[model samples]
Target: MLYRLDISNILFLDIETVPEKEAFNALSEEKQLLWEQKTKYARKDEFTPAEFYERAGIWAEFGKIVCISVGYLTYTGENRNFRVTTFYGEEDKLLKEFKQLLETHFNQPKHLLCGHNAKEFDFPYIARRMVIHGIQLPYKLDLFGKKPWEIPHLDTMELWKFGDYKHYTSLKLMANVLGIPSPKDDMEGSMVRQVYYEEGDIDRIITYCELDVVTTAQVFLRLRGDALLPHDAIKKV
Candidate 1:
């Protein structure tokens, strides 16, 4: 059962992304046409490609990761602590560092990657961005030959679904219902592009991303019927 799994073996993470370019006109003509075609149906006639560009961070092909925040638990005797750290700045550099982290420390078969809605978004986005940058995929992110049961990944949203594929849950909503602290008190995902591009607030985005990791970890703990982590026990490493 999930409750029986070791907390220290799971790496909980979240990522913040923004469009590759600050403005739609900044893209090359070829890419502009491609983006138009790619988002044609989604934008319909209601909004032009430029108008829809703000939401481009949802797609890895058009977006770039700005921050990746990860959290993990460690236990010493009966005491436990949750530590978090963030990788930011140049996309390629942060991605390589994150890869090194997985390959070096969390590469064991028993290690699992967990996040809220990560299976559908964060996990694949990182893998796709890594491939676009020509970086070799770590075993945890590379899922080519792994069977369904063999994939060492977990999603709290999927767990909440309880085999109901039709349901969708946001991390904030999940935390609200579970009595976990809200991660969106300061800002929401939709504002990330504005914060990063216009405001030049990388630190704010990193804080938001790290809060998400902590909230996801808390959601997992609540799911496993464990005690909520005290605020003092969470350290930023």
Candidate 2:
């Protein structure tokens, strides 16, 4: 079934996020108390709420997406090319741009959204943030009534799991085992907050996010027993 699906119908994507505020004290006092309650168990006797604040980006309510990079395949006869684009800058602004792309181009029932570990992270985070910003949920992101098999979404990590619920794999590890280039060569995910907030180097982060999108598409092709994309085949738009 995987081989039968058209690669062009899939929109491979990745997102980079950071805490909503620059520091714990930047949040409202009420929100700070809520944050403590929210992470109480996870940081129990280990790290204070202020200390654990670095990971707040993992939760949509506490974080904001800084970038969303998407890639899709185009075919001219047998020649295939992957074009990548990024919607970035202000959170609400970027989310609106990303929503436009989905509604304008990838709204078909046959279209799919793919990312590494997207089911657990990227997909839901985007949806939640969209709602928070009062942006209408796009059809592909709105899964309120769809049955499990009816959702137009794909997770490379879930596919690799092969029903092993106990198993977990990082994108770097999966790319390594599958012989795809590692996207983390430039910087680690943990540094995104610092890079964005401190260094104010969103261009660097954008490049990193785009690389992950390309690598994810490559992983999908490899999983389908197809040829990996050549370096020249990936073009940033």
Candidate 3:
């Protein structure tokens, strides 16, 4: 008999960022000028700390991860099912809970963590933020010290099309190209920060995050040639 680790051991997540209020206030006049010269279109000079927080989409505001959506799917016998953990709280508290979940369920590296753009963005963002919150990170999210191109990373975008190495490819377009239904229309990533700031609504973000996780699972299973049952693995979130 053979045993296989389940996808429930994996946590699929995406992060949104916005500018930090303190960091925005601390920007020196000289640095501000240089930043303006760099991000030419950015009105960094004109933005008050409040304005910066209001406008930051994926870096400073929602970038701070006011919401973190977690999804897990695993095979049991001949069936696959998923559970979602939707969290809306301070980033530090959320990171602690997220890390704890990974640490508890995944005591070994055999249980791989999977996310769409995790290697380049999601994983690093979560790991660093965890560190900032003084939480110990799990092995799955600890890739900061690993050499580039050598770490165990499975990005859906890279794995797809054998990695064309293009400048940019959003998850929306990737899903579309692969004939998968994208969740972008639910609410654009750009609107995340605003919704979080104004309405304090995380439902949209959770929907968005869980959908990506499901789609990524599809891409992964497809790339593995449907080694898992097609119906079991392809459920829409």
Candidate 4:
């Protein structure tokens, strides 16, 4: 069934996010209280709100998206090529650029947004952030009244699950198991906040994000029993 879908209609993507502020203490008193209240259940009296603040990027309200790297396949004659582009920098600008990309090229009903664990994280996160920024939701991200089958979102992690709801697979793990190269040689998701806030290197993070997008596309191709694109076949634009 996966093989039946057109590769060109699928937009492979990955995002990198960081807490809205560099430190938890930098938040206003009201926001600090709100964070504490919001995370109490998850913290379970173990870690203080400040201690758990490192994971704030996982929540749309407390975080800002720094990069959204996207890729799609193009066929020429008998050769297939993958091209990647990244929208990065200030959150609002990046979001606007990404929205424009979606609105322009991938707005068709048949186009699908593909990511690793996107249904659980990336898809909703992007939608919520768009709302916060007062940007109109793109056709693909706006899932308000759409039926289950009508939502054109593809999650590589969900596809690999095959209905085992209790199991979780990281993109790195799936790549390793499937013989695809892991994207996290320099930094993992755990280190994104530090790299963004302390190191102040968004280019590094964008590179990491782009690699994940490529790995995700490769993983999808592997699932369809197709050969992975050669290194020279990948283009950055």
Candidate 5:
């Protein structure tokens, strides 16, 4: 099925998010209570709200996107090249810029978004953050009345599932199984918040995010029985 689609029409991307505030104590009392209620079922008796705060980035209500790295393929004769660009800095600014990129270039119905577990995480998270920032949802992210078949989103992890509802696969794990290079060589997702807040290094986070996008694109190529992209073929723009 993947082989039937045109690679150039897919925009591969990944996002990095962090809790709205640097620490649990930084949240207002009302928000703190809300967070507590939000996590009660998952935290149970194992950890306090403060102790579980690090995981808040996974929830759109408590987190903010810091970076969104996107990539697309270009062809030159028989060679394929991937160019990746990142939008970072203030969340609102980056979100708007990302929205503009979609509107200006990838607005066609045939254009699709591909990422690992994106349908569950990346796609929805971006849309939620856009709404919170008062930015209009781009056509690709707005799924209100669109039929399920009309949604132009693809998830590598979901494709790997093959309808196995109980199974879950991480991008890193999938890369390993598919013989693609791992993207987590420098850091894991858990360290992103610390790197962003404490180190004040948004560049590092952007690099990490871009690598995930590259890995996802590579994974998709492998799934389609295509050869892995050479290092020289990936360009940062």
Candidate 6:
């Protein structure tokens, strides 16, 4: 039997996360050094959480959200049409728009939620912030207390990992290994986080997130059916 998800009824979502603390970003290099020394996730060779905040745009603009691009895709007339609705933009309007989409467009407690690392990263990040903004949590995410397999979670990362403890397998690698197109090859994740901060360009960040979402949705389709043809994933801006 197929997973309880209908291909036509899911929203492919992804978010660009940023830190919420000002000191996380405004610290001077020397002070950043001191902060990093005390920070738990930072190391000399790795982008510590502090390092992530300082160098990456993960927490740009007082750590406010930069953008969230939600794409609607489904098998229609033997073709897939992907429409990315603006849940987020350079302004905070997208958040309210996104909330409306989740509440209105999606059938609560029924529509499946698809993402790459959404179960672990994207979903929680979005939901937590939504609650912070006083919006209701989407029903699919309300499956916190249910059994793992009980909830409708089509996490591409978890599906591929199959019980692996690696830091993270790049979405590009997963796409190639699964015979899906790695459109994410254009803008790397490190750059997604970096470009958002240095250039303050929300467009690049949105494009990056959208590319990853396309790759992720492609992965999901492949996982559902082996015969699904790869879409026209040519290099596009």
Tens digit of per-residue lDDT, candidate 6, span 1-237:
345566667778788765444346565677566555555454456666554555433423234566776766655576666666444553346666776777787865567778887877777666666666766666666666888767866778877777886857767787888887556345666565456655677677777887777777777777777454345522232
Candidate 1 lDDT by residue in tens digits, 1-237:
988899899999999999999999999999989999999999999999999999999999999999999999999898899999999999999999999999999999999999999999999999999999999999999999999999989999999999898999998889899998664458889999999999999998999899999999999999999999999899999
Total backbone clashes of model 1?
A: 0
C-alpha TM-score for every candidate: 0.98, 0.98, 0.73, 0.97, 0.98, 0.75
Please, what are the lDDT tens digits per residue for candidate 5 over residues 200-237?
A: 98888888999999999999999999999999999999
lDDT of 3 by residue, 13-63 (tens): 666654443344456676555444544456556765445444543433124
- Candidate with the larger TM-score of 2 and 6: 2
Q: After superposition, how far is residue 4 of candidate 2 from its true place, in Å?
A: 0.9
Candidate 6, residue 93: CA error in Å?
3.0
Global Cα lDDT for candidate 3: 0.61
True-structure Cα RMSD, model 5: 1.0
Give, for candidate 4, the lowest lDDT window spanning 10 residues: 181-190
Q: Write the per-residue lDDT of candidate 4 for residues 1-237, one digit (tens) a residue.
A: 999999999999999999998889999999999999999999997999999999999999999899999999999999999999999988889999999999899999989999999999999999999999999999899998999999999999999999999879999889899999665458888899999999999888988999999999999999999999999999999
lDDT values for all models: 0.95, 0.94, 0.61, 0.93, 0.94, 0.64
Report lDDT (Cα) of residue 212, candidate 3: 67
Judging by TM-score, tell me the better candidate of 2 and 4: 2
lDDT (Cα, tens digit) per residue for candidate 2, span 165-221: 988898888889999977555898999999999999999999999988998999999
Poorest 10 consecutive residues by lDDT, candidate 2: 180-189
Per-candidate alpha-carbon RMSD to the true structure: 0.9, 0.9, 5.1, 1.0, 1.0, 4.5
Q: Give the TM-score of candidate 4.
A: 0.97
